[model samples]
Target: MFLKRIVLSLFCFHVVLGKTPEIREDVRKFPDGFLFGVASASYQVEGAWDEDGKSESIWDHDTHKIPSPIDDMSTGDIADDSYHLYKRDVEMVREMGVDFYRISLSWTRIMPTSFPDKINQAGVDYYNNLINELLKHNIKPMITLFHWDMPQKLQEMGGWTNPNIVDWYGDYVRTAYELFGDRVKYWITINEPTQICLYGYGLNLLAPRLNIPGVADYLCSKNLLLAHARAYHIYDEEFRASQGGNISITLSAQWYEPESELYATASREYLQFDSGVYAHPIFSKEGDWPSIVKEKVARKSAEQGFARSRLPDFTPEEIEYVRGTSDFFGLNHYSSYFVNMDEDTINSYAVPSRADDIGVNVFKLNEWVLSEFSSTDYVPWGFYKLLNYFREEYDNPPIFITENGFGTYYTGLDDDERVTYYRGYIGAVLDAIDDGTNIIGYTAWCLMDNFEWTKGYTVRYGIYHVDFESPNRTRTPRKSAFVYKEIVRTRSLDIGFEPDTSVMTIDEGH
Candidate 1:
């Protein structure tokens, strides 16, 4: 099934060019106080899987135990060696002139036993050094507590599927706040719960590969939402008064465009299934599962002889607890898909799966422009629509774009495609802002190339290139890096500006 998805993803190359929106000069300038930054996750970049008292994370276990899942049979055992060369990472971001640098804390690294009973001082010191280094360079730190690298011991204890994780996660987050809340001003409780729950638990595409579709995925989602609320409440009650920081959860959202007017409802429901499952609980006024999602899953579960709906329901108290937990909507958007519904599409999934429950087929239109090296389609207008949807649905919450980037096969430094991708997407962001969306920040997906999960090193999404073969894992600035630097430095997206590719250097104060 995983291999089948991979083959389907590769079909994105068959897409034709769509109409690219013209960037008006007036819409190119970003709002004042709007932040610019780059983001990286610990498991993807931090390679000290077991170094300095750090225990194994689920990624460590998965890649080692079943290397076949990774395209290159590679592991993140030494990805970018950021555990040792974090100073160089700081330098790269400084050179880019970003206002902040977002990174995730490794659960296993800080609490090697998967609990707060024994704090790893060496792990704590390593993060302290990174945080201190960023602050010295005037870069604010935006830290995510969990970015899918749960401790293996905790996974052995049933991971997110186990309701006990609500307390387990709450304790872990409290320890993080107590240790680093003094310096870090922006905290993301968890990054992309849908990716963590659905992909990792349902699809078997990622680590921990639970793959118990419909049942396990729904259980994971329920517990994850509670865990997120627990973390938010912990920060609110304990750290917010003293630390003065903002916290939220990031969602991996992709705009789902209906294939036609006939399929509008299908697209809306697909969006609900894709991201609304998580978003509705936290951001909606009612704060339970979406009615359509509940109805659909319940009907299907009854047909399958299950005693209850496959999607776990939030109790009244749980609903209120999760409701309004986020300070801002942390979003990670990459592309868009056209959603369709028909008997054939519904029958294509395993009988008791998420796809079966959603009852929709989502695919990129052949008319959309395709990224040459990745499955992501270029559809900036879709981004514009998604922002509008969020503004209208969630009553105009402040939005922080936590991760957005173009991925590619490791082509050298002259990455024109990525530059174009950024320019188009940022233009869409400006359009959304002009339409009264409360977008406060934008973060490029990463600072440099590192371990890219299941695709392994086969795909790259970094502004700077890392030579994985080199002992230094040498970093070199790509063309997109210079383009991004200009945008950050000037606080404007000059669509026509072409940066000089001759030299890459840190600007004088950076």
Candidate 2:
């Protein structure tokens, strides 16, 4: 009987271990006065969609319709009810002692017709109120001009691909500068241009769904970068003098690794093609398209039968104008990976080069990690390594941690894993700062759970958990809320700050 029990135990262990490598956490250090805050995009958190003369955004239709490609088909129609409960939201910010609040402006809400010919006063007022509230509490606002919510009308007019979009985007950006530039000092010309190009045109996954991956996504990527370049030029030449504001675009990233031992030499070579092409023109020491990206895209275009490379060319003048356009860097990072860029990526996966565009095989560290990021190990040290990469590769520019947070599969107020996540992450930022990375500040990925793009609302990255069941979309402080608030109040990571279960219920109400 004892022998039988031992055999059964061994069988159960093998079954349970079908596939989960023993993951290890690498502890790291962090820097001081490295600002820590939280973030929320307009479309995800602010739910007064179509209210107060606000028209529809590209995402509204995607989340509301049948056969909705969204994982949960859950819309942000009443997300956190932040539009109404902003006061409560601010209180949370205050309690958390956040030094800055990163907020995005919905294009449809600010300019209902998707043009400057008309400004929705109600829409303007709603944003004005939110901004003023942040300033009132001494929280500086980091405003993102666009965050995936394009005006539905823009979709009808051919969004980013149409070359004419250069002028259209310029007009909208100029108007935004004129209207909100004074109050909003930090402006992101665009958010995740890679995703916009890849998902919108290539995958037919995001709104205004189009499935011309090799074709449309690549074309869109070029036009989209030009649009960003033009927008940056407008701000630098026109607005910087008067508006006295700073501008940059945000990129979503995962660390890369080459397939074999020799792959490390060309690791960044792969990154230069994927993200570097998009970023080098704007942020590199000598801003222009990386030679590798230009050569590959051009070669691929010819092979695929195009008049010219799918990538739009920038004149010498255009290159100079775009270089050094940014006053700072905005990075939205989640995880890191080992990248393989050979037939493993192309022939085997058939993933549009838009994804593994590097023309090399990209293999991951593990499979249990989840999402597109499963390729990456959750090494906080990767954050340190990435920061070092930015400093050494691109000229060391001031960077803002536009978004970073740990995601989980459950909902509970007593979230200790989140505490450890912040402990490690925030510490890593400090480590980078100590190493002279010039990281200005860090913002938590979310203030409250809202609509996560492709994954839908299933993922929660909030410090303060939102109750979807509550009619008011009530937000009660999660255990992490108290953990974060105390860190804020003390202005220090409480090495001495051991979280007790009691803090979860004890409200030193703000």
- Best by the lDDT measure: 1
Error of 2 at 285 (Å): 3.4
TM-scores for candidates 1 onward, in order: 0.95, 0.87
- Kindly state the number of residue pairs that clash in model 1: 0
Q: Cα deviation of 462 in candidate 2 (Å)?
A: 0.6
Tens-digit lDDT track of model 2 for 181-280: 8878888888887778877877778876877766677667667777887888898888888878788888876566444444553465666766776778
Deviation from native of the Cα of residue 42 in model 2, angstroms: 0.6
**Candidate 2 — what's its lDDT?**
0.72
Question: Which run of 10 residues does model 2 get worst, by summed lDDT?
Answer: 15-24
Best by TM-score: 1
lDDT of 1 by residue, 140-227 (tens): 9999999999999889899999999999999999999999999999999989888888889987988889889999899999999999
Error of 1 at 279 (Å): 0.7
